[model samples]
Target: MKKLMISVVAAALVLTMAGCGSKDSGGTKVKFATDAAYAPMEYMDKDKVAGFDIDFLAEVMKEAGLAYSVTNTGWDTMLTSVQQGKEYQAGISSVSITDERKQTYDYTAPYFESTNMILVKEGSPIKSALDLKDKKVAVQISTTADTLMTKIMGGDNKSLKRMDNNTLALMELESNGVDAVVADIAIIREYVKNNPNKKFVSIADAKNFESEYYGILLPKGSDLKAKLDPAIKKVIENGKYATVYKKWFGQEPDTKKLLDQK
Candidate 1:
């Protein structure tokens, strides 16, 4: 359900920001902005940006015959900068495609399937989305998880704590400040795998949490969409995508189903 987004109308951004892209033998590299906070998708590995989305983007750009670079500029900066289409040409922070966001930007064909999942301390009574109705919950602000939880908890419910990032949201749950944290499955699964001693459990409620797809965020009418789509289709079909998927997830991706999605 989420990893990226910030509610900003992103008017013309300042073009003064330094540290942009460099040229390559092919041409100037496509500049990408990402919030290096979403793991198994995109996150900081020390000083370097590393994860599934980063590795996947390498394949995508290779297929498209382009050079590219990604920067860890945080979610809000990434969203607004990419929206302006000045500082960065595209964004790939596990950003989910939704109707509300479609009004602001165009997106490449979906590359990943995801859904919100609940991360609760082991032995918690919560089992589904409905179970959190009266419970304290934390979610990253302005994400699909935030949007959906707002509806479930009622618009102004104080029980829903919206944090600046999922790392903070999960921390709140770990500290018992909240009963659960709602975030994308990739994030939840990665956290659980790395923190086995945390004694956390993940629950997938298929009824309340529906399928969502992640796409490369682009500014409206951007030319990259034309170049990226075919490359995405080719990589997904020709087995390149599955290799990247299995590298991060340790399992084969459902390319058949992924291709069938709009």
Candidate 2:
């Protein structure tokens, strides 16, 4: 999720890797695709891609000494493009590393931790995931939130409303089309912070939503993992990772927990 999504329509962009602005040793520049709808993770800041993931990717690419560029693409496009390894070599829009995805893509070491959160208008009776089992809930399609809610509400649950991205899911809640919107905690929190007038509340249900890790995604069998893992580890050990985390999250990350998952 670029912020859980981590798009419905994404305009493509080609940008130089953050920092040093140098090319990889092989000089073969790579492309990283992402859905830039999830705010605070990746989003369109006017025309440029801005957010934590954009900043983190700059650090990872610089550490790996790889030449790369990130583009704004829809969620499905990011998944399919990275899988082909032709137009896009990798992706990093807050993508969760799951057993099913590992079969289709190679993931760099776990970099961040997240879980689905329930979002509702203030004063709503919905307090947790269970409360939404029979209530109309909105979620972005193909995201971990969607998958988790499906398991809890059943795949055929009519109350489960799936949107193309978190933005629309939140909109559904704004218009009272759904009882709640489920998505990554970061996306839920950021939206609430940005829309104080909306009076939204985010609920964390540890009992139903398990913690998950985020990783840089690559095509199955892609060799990029070999270069990225060490670079990602170095950033965490040296405190750069925490610096970026603090900048965006306003608090120190559980670096120890993140490293242990690697």
Candidate 3:
């Protein structure tokens, strides 16, 4: 009887440990968070979440043998949520990998790169960044461009207005509430594509605009990075990332060395 009881206890311990080591029932499911409203990156399509980053993630996840789901959170919320180890395991929004972000969270190899650009209504007086001095400029709050604008305008540009999202900022530009908007070049592309009536153009030959590289944001110390980096390198080397780029952005990756330089 004593021997039988000890055997039962050992079996129970083994079973408990096995359960602890098992993956979530979602079956390799990874929680991917993005700003969902950023179309051509991640957004709602016919009640289904789909976009460039979503499609790219689907392919990458398959290549990595992982299953995943996406959550459409606000941009700033997505970043902070992942850092706090909330529901999401990774962030796939077109998030630029920067030294500042690195101080908070780890990032995967860049999947997309772009320069900062200005979007203004056709025939607008704001021909370049310099032309906008003392003029009202709009940007998404807490974005790289927001900080850059602050620096460009010389100390505090109290006239600068902040919006919660890109769409709103762009809308303000349309209504003449702001002189122009500073946004990612890729984002500007999609916006222009959808809003043909707007006849938009980039500020020609603008300096002080920073090029940025988008990366998959992962929680610091997460094992997911180990699986992600090599797989990303695979896509880059096998010409897969470029192929995906043409499908969504209507252009190929610019091999020119961009940002990430000192």
Candidate 4:
């Protein structure tokens, strides 16, 4: 009888562990990879991650009845992780859903929109990407801005240097080591906020290549979209998304207008 009771207890423990680790029939635990260093979009505040993207995901997951977690694996790695399906189920690093990315991974409807801009030190001569010619410019490795820089400078501009993080690129601009840095406008705002003494300037919207925004990345042929699609639709309808948006971005997001046209 003693041996039988021990056997039953062991089975019960194994079942419990499996239950804890497995996703429910209608729910899934999404591992979201992002660059935790980008502020206002995604960043670490003390021990917790808090930013526009983080807060937006938390709300969307709750509405979808999905379990998810965010892992900081840098921007470049975040892209490859979802592609390889090594550690994450999706990515939320303000990744612009381009045709190239869509060829491999599915993207959800866009949750935000932005345009790239040039950030120069206060009172610098650098005014635009053209002005960056023959000048030292820092760009985050593998970002849209970095790609655009390559296109403008023949993909081998001697002055264009890649950095691991956008913040570091901005720092180079602050220290006067680089003439300018290229990144999204929203990210530039956050950088300037953190650097009080450094005044960053952006030229009026110049006609250049721009990137559209989208969320949701799944491994090729993954079935997670059924769950994410409904949650995104419901969140937009019930206004929970807007509430969360206001909390992070200080204004309501216009997701409905953009997604409606789709």
Candidate 5:
């Protein structure tokens, strides 16, 4: 009887260990982080997260057979949060892929192409980049737009107004707190489209503004990149990418034009 009881206890222990292992390996659940203040890319629609990147990533995750959840983190901390793995595994907030950032994070292939644009109140007389000289330009802090503005207008230029997010920067422009806002062209266009009463106009200078490519960001050497990269390519090849692009931008993606730009 003693031997039988010992054998039963051993079997129970094996079962418990197996159950724990199964739970850990049962499914792929990636925690995704984003700053939802940038519309048409990733933004809060009502109480839920919805936008181009959200929809596009949902398809990519499905293709990769991974379950995922998104958390709205502050833009300043979003990248670091993914890098630290304290709260998220990946970030996708129209994050531009740049050599400087590559050292800190692994990124999926370029998912979207973007360019900088100058936004001004309608009939404000700021028709082009030259008009921005000595103007108070508002930009989201730490974004590529801010970097561009600092480079163009000088870092210590008192005309530069840094805001926490693009929406706030636009508000500053509407209230005449700033003469203009410099930001991603798609973001500016989306904002103007959604707020018909706001009276905003955008100016693009292809010669002056370099096009940027956005990608999904993960911690350095993250295995999620292996799964996500292939899925991104598959979506582009299968028309799903264009479908999502059209849903958000109101026109089908010119795949050849976008891919060739890189």
Candidate 6:
């Protein structure tokens, strides 16, 4: 009888240990990394992170019945932290979904569309892509804007000034350090809206600029994508996405058009 009791207790302990191991996977918490410097997408609001992406993800997590935490990992290391270091389960920092990135990282369905724009001070002569020839331009290094600018004006051009982030690039343009700043249209528009004193205008090259889609970054073969992609679709289908869209952008999103973009 003593041996039977011991075996039963041992089985109970094994069951307990198994339960503990599965706790986190049972939809309790997910940790995420993000670069909170990109406004209207993700940015620091005092000690807290706030923005369109933050709010959208919050809603998605709520719908999926999971608690989450976000760490403000800088843009340069955000992808590496998830893909190689395995530091976080996923990342969402307006990361563009490109063919190159797909090889190394898994991504949720594209959530946002973006395009490059050339931002110039109120009276700058750089009105178009052609006008940027031999003119000093500021852009965040390794960004889509940098890629586009390099293609427009050769990589050897001495006029290209690469900065670490969009804010710095815009600041350089404002200070007359560069003739113009090339960055995402949404980011430049948000900055200009908030800083009325610093008059900045964005010009788009309709024929030259290619639109890119943004997606959440996950480790290759991550099961998190299965959870997130469906949640994203649910948010769009239930009108929650439109509410968040209007809150940040001051207008409703073109639901049909954006959803159809792939």
Winner on lDDT between 2 and 3 is 2
Per-residue accuracy of model 5 over 1-262 as CA lDDT, tens digit each: 0000001111111000001111232475677877676777877777677789888888887788777777776465566677787667888888888877877788888889888899888888777776787899998877777777778889999899987677798899888999999888888888888888977788998877888888888898888888888888888889999999999898877677655543
Candidate 2's clash total is 6
Candidate 2 per-residue C-alpha lDDT over 77-176 given as tens digits, one digit per residue, 9 for 90 to 100: 8887888899899998888888777777889999999988999888999888888888899998877888888888999988899887788998899999
What candidate 3 gets wrong by more than 4 Å, as runs, is 1-26, 204-206, 255-262
Q: Ten consecutive residues with minimal summed lDDT in candidate 5?
A: 1-10
Residue 139 of model 6, lDDT score: 85
Which ten-residue region of model 2 has the weakest summed lDDT?
A: 1-10
Query: Which candidate, 2 or 5, would have the higher TM-score against the true structure?
Result: 2
How good is model 2 by TM-score?
A: 0.90
The candidate 3 region of ten consecutive residues with least summed lDDT is 1-10
The deviation in Å at residue 13 for candidate 1 is: 14
Sorting all predicted structures by TM-score, with the top scorer first, yields: 1, 2, 6, 5, 3, 4
Error of 4 at 167 (Å): 2.0
lDDT of 6: 0.75
> On a 0 to 1 TM-score scale, where does candidate 4 land against the true structure?
0.80
Q: What is candidate 1's CA lDDT for residue 80?
A: 85
Name the better of 4 and 5 by TM-score.
5
* CA lDDT of every candidate: 0.85, 0.83, 0.69, 0.68, 0.76, 0.75
For every model shown, the clashing-pair count is 0, 6, 0, 0, 0, 0
Candidate with maximal lDDT = 1
Q: What stretches of model 5 exceed 4 Å from their correct place?
A: 1-26, 260-262
- How large is the C-alpha RMSD of every model relative to the true structure? 3.6, 3.0, 12.7, 11.2, 13.2, 12.7
TM-score of 5: 0.85
Clashing pairs in 6: none
Candidate 3 lDDT over 103-209, as tens digits, reads 77888877776667788877887777777678888887777777777776754676787776778989998888988888777678788888887788767434677
Deviating ranges (above 4 Å) for candidate 1: 3-26
Positional deviation of residue 218's Cα in model 2 after best superposition, in angstroms: 0.9
